[model samples]
Target: MRTQVAIIGSGPSGLLLGQLLTNAGIENIVLDRVDRNYILGRIRAGVLEQGTVGLLDEAKAGKRMHAEGIVHEGTSLAFNGTHHRIDLKELTGGKTVTIYGQTEVTHDLMDRRSETGGATIYNAKNVQPHGYEGDRPYITYEMEGIEHRIDCDFIVGCDGYHGPSRASVPENAIKTYEKIYPFGWLGVLADVPPVSDELIYANHERGFALCSMRSHTRSRYYIQCPSSDKAEEWSDDGFWDELRRRLPKEQAESLITGASIEKSIAPLRSFVAEPMRFGRLFLAGDAAHIVPPTGAKGLNLAASDVHYLFEGLREFYGEGSSAGIDDYSRRALARVWKAVRFSWSMTMLLHRFPENGEFGQKIQEAELDYLVHSRAASAALAENYVGLPF
Candidate 1:
């Protein structure tokens, strides 16, 4: 198939790019290694930044989001058994993050794209980007073991952490930077009501816990855990007991009432690659960088990348100029790096590390204390949390 842009993966970045290009009257095809049923099959981030809300709104992806997404006033931070509320709207000039699950976002995008006159191929296998710098560089994939090809002007890689996009970039074409943490987040989704009024980030000597909601009936949260254990080994009772230990004792909060437990182990890591573009292929989203989810910047950063990249492509095509295209890599990296730092900071600060020296723990506590008491320090957290306006 021939297209102006060929997008890999159906995650937020790929879909958004397809939508944006479609709106711009640029033809594009989105290829994925999995079907729609498999694409929306996992549990993921639910929180959307205030700026994310605006961007989706402008792109018309916000109507369903605003209607279905749970809007929170702000989030809470707990330490020493006391909670400090950060009024997000007050701090960020009335910006609010939404508690809409990523699954919902994908479903909404899929429904819209179905009527959008765009290509969404699934179960695509053996996908390869070859013959760059040509009028018809293409991606090869197989569905049901039948090889197929997608011819295009450029290929956009939005594949997640473990996809083929990263490997496709030739050696020395990109510089890989990464930091892996000592701990990982154990996340869960329950049908029970949320334990608090807003999302709460707790700093416990035992570990860290996040109290967030998916809807009126579904609550989501996370706990810091050792990186070795798998969720399958954690029984239902074990999950609840772990929750009780992390949560404050005063509240009789328990996960029950037909709440099916789904757990995921999240490794805290920060990574970035120099020059997201390689010839006719451009890497965006996890194919480009990954931040720990503590800052809730993962999905938003991916969306931001596609936004800038889409604009650059449009400018290039319209003006027959390569300036915007040339600058796409640098411009995308600036916002992505900021988000990486934010995620890394949030992850390191809130979660306890066994390997942390006594002095390091003390230093961490001191910083947390300053964050709660100092307005300047708190505002910095608030801005990064609520997200920077792009």
Candidate 2:
């Protein structure tokens, strides 16, 4: 059990980091509590920023993704019985987003790993590392209740928010930045065809409604609600009817089918932890930070972190520049803050508060209207949604 690096959590960030490190000719071991994270058909997000496409391409995993992924040049903002289309691709010079689910991305990476198999362990539990200064840093874990140990040089934390990796770092050193939004998103995956060619983000008197898709036959959507709302209580008919009410009146009512196959709720939020690195330990993906899903920044930000770390690690391995690793946290924070700000901005503009009175509602609606018509405002959104150049 000896390797150059030890990666925790095999989710998007962890997997992508493994791929990046592999390209850098650095050997690493991936540890996961789950034995296998196949396509459970979980619905997280379906949008990608313009710049994220390039990063995926460099990984060589973009080959199959580009073929299966749907590209959307524009999205709609429906209000006052009209739909406003934002030409994201046109504004960014063919720089559009792909409507691919997060689950699919994970599956693609897992498949790619088989072709480039390296040190990895599934269902590995009780993983512990000691002696960061030594060449053979010991990593001990349980594989099917059997204790095991492997030595590695450095540890990388990609295990996400709740994993033990964060706790392993010194408590006082981590500065956690977080905000709990007033609302949650009731995400539903349906058997119905898509309601539109592109995503439709609507702000209604009732709540915010999102119309997006999974594939040719599958449809995905979100309805804003209180943090306490539960999907199990929401019947299929009730969900469809409410979606219709929130959707734009002009859109064909026939677009939705009779039933939704699944429904789930996710609390909206914006969070970030400072100093992503601690000695030989480093944080990536949900292990490092989280953002509200409004701007579809979570996965992209994770992708960016791995890319930055991969470059820094390459410098450290090839040029023996520890400076690159030392500055990893600062460099990653620049992009992380950008995503946090965008996600918060989108959440505030779309969701309503219980304290909002009639005048407040009027002001909010006015802002939405302005965002629809104003080129400058739309450009601002375009820049954020497609991602700032990293």
lDDT (C-alpha, whole model) for all candidates: 0.81, 0.80
Off by over 4 Å in 2: 38-41, 129-138
**Alpha-carbon error at 247 in model 1, in Å?**
2.7
Q: Model 1 misses residue 287 by how many Å? A: 0.5
TM-scores for all predictions: 0.95, 0.95
- Writing each residue's lDDT as its tens digit, candidate 1 over 223-264 gives 888889787777766766776776666532543434456778
lDDT of 2 by residue, 323-357 (tens): 88888999999999988998888877776676886
Model 2 worst lDDT window (10 residues): 35-44
Candidate 1: residue pairs that collide: none
Candidate 2 residue pairs in backbone clash: 1-150, 1-151, 160-287
